[model samples]
Target: MTDEHRSGCPINLSLEVFGDKWSLLILRDMIFGAQRHFRDLQKGSQEGIASNILASRLKHLVELGMLTKRPDPAHKQKAIYSLTEASIQLVPVMAALGSWGLRWQPASEELSIRAQLLEEGGPELWNRFMAELRDEHLGIPAEPSADGKLVRERLQEAYLAVLAERGKSLPSKA
Candidate 1:
């Protein structure tokens, strides 16, 4: 929708919208880390995104319908960004990418723990995660089940456990 594509390829079309590192990283923070505010996304970013780049990618994602932005009720000047259903569906893709990264790239244990859990959890876990996302971002009730661990909570727990093992304090939740 931003511009005419060179081809009708699906991958190419996806790349045009979210191919860049920053955009995906932004989505990752929103999906996994539950960062909704602009400052939270900027500061909580492990990759240390610049202010202008974060602004641009946020705008681009909104334009592409991957995200929606609105004024934060608690903070008059700040905006809250939420993932659209289209972006919510990217959970599996993110999991695959994380799995690949864990295999091929050097990743810190705490950072890559979610990927490990997701790879081990497979599709069922991904579905639960998507359900949880819908609950958080869309105000839909999460599927009723006996499984007590929300995917986000489990990932945070894993991260905290790793940090505790290393004698590090858990970073304050954003």
Candidate 2:
């Protein structure tokens, strides 16, 4: 099927890329789950997105300019996919979705950082995080390279810290 989508409204335009369950879920894994590659996405969710679906989503997101795949410096077979400005802009959307899940969803207690995500970093925090991401990804209002860290690297670092705080180690690099 051809992707003849409505460009009338910004929301419709956005839904063209992120309308489906798997698409946003894939994006969420990138944003919230620290998923930079296929394996990171595959292992975490209990709902178990099929590999074929996952693969398709990855490609689709990349095609729509939401993600970019870079050769993984650490692994031969793996490619590290980072969110582009398009995808990073979805941070607020994700934060709202997360807030909803935390509030009404019955599976609240099982979530790893429900309290932090919901209270400590709701829309305001999501915006700040997105600002940092935009500054890093799109070079918005450019900042000095004092740290040499990109938005992608900063995000990965933050995810690792969260994992460490929860008494887990970053999954060993393969």
Candidate 3:
């Protein structure tokens, strides 16, 4: 439905919205890393995204209906970004992409751990993750679980563990 579609092809249409290198990285941070603020996204980016590029992509994503931006209640001058349902549905796509990357690319173990877990866990894990994302971004109640290990926490723990093994501490929060 976007005016910028190059063709009727589904892949082309999807690429039109998120084809750029930076957009999906931004979404990945939001979806997997739970980084909602612009400053956090810029500073915490493992790929070192430029500030201007991050700003532009955030605006583009909001315009394309993948994200919503609203004033942060805790900070008057700051904005909080949240994923829309469309972006939430991208969980499986991201998992698949990560799976492919892990198989063929030279990704580091710490970085690829989540993808490995996702590929192994399959749809059931992805569904739980999507449900958690909805709870975080859409204010919906996440399904209750007996075991309290959140996917996000597990990923972070893995990253931290790698850092610990490397004798590198987590970066100080801004």
How accurate locally, in lDDT, is each candidate?
A: 0.92, 0.70, 0.90
Models 1 onward score TM values of 0.93, 0.68, 0.92
The candidate, 2 or 3, that scores higher on lDDT is 3
Candidate 3, after superposition: displacement of residue 58 in Å? Answer: 0.6
Compare the candidates by lDDT and give the number of the best one.
Answer: 1
Please give the distance, in angstroms, between residue 161's alpha carbon in candidate 3 and its true position after superposition.
2.5
Task: Encode model 2's per-residue lDDT on 11-70: one tens digit a residue.
Answer: 887788899999888887767666777988877654588889999989998898998887
Higher-ranked by lDDT: 1 or 2: 1
Error of 2 at 86 (Å): 1.3
Error of 1 at 14 (Å): 0.7
TM-score of 3: 0.92
Residue-level lDDT tens digits of model 3 in 1-174: 566666889999899888888998999999998999999999888788988999999999999999999999999999999999999999999999999999999998778788988999899989999999999999999976567877788778888888888888776554
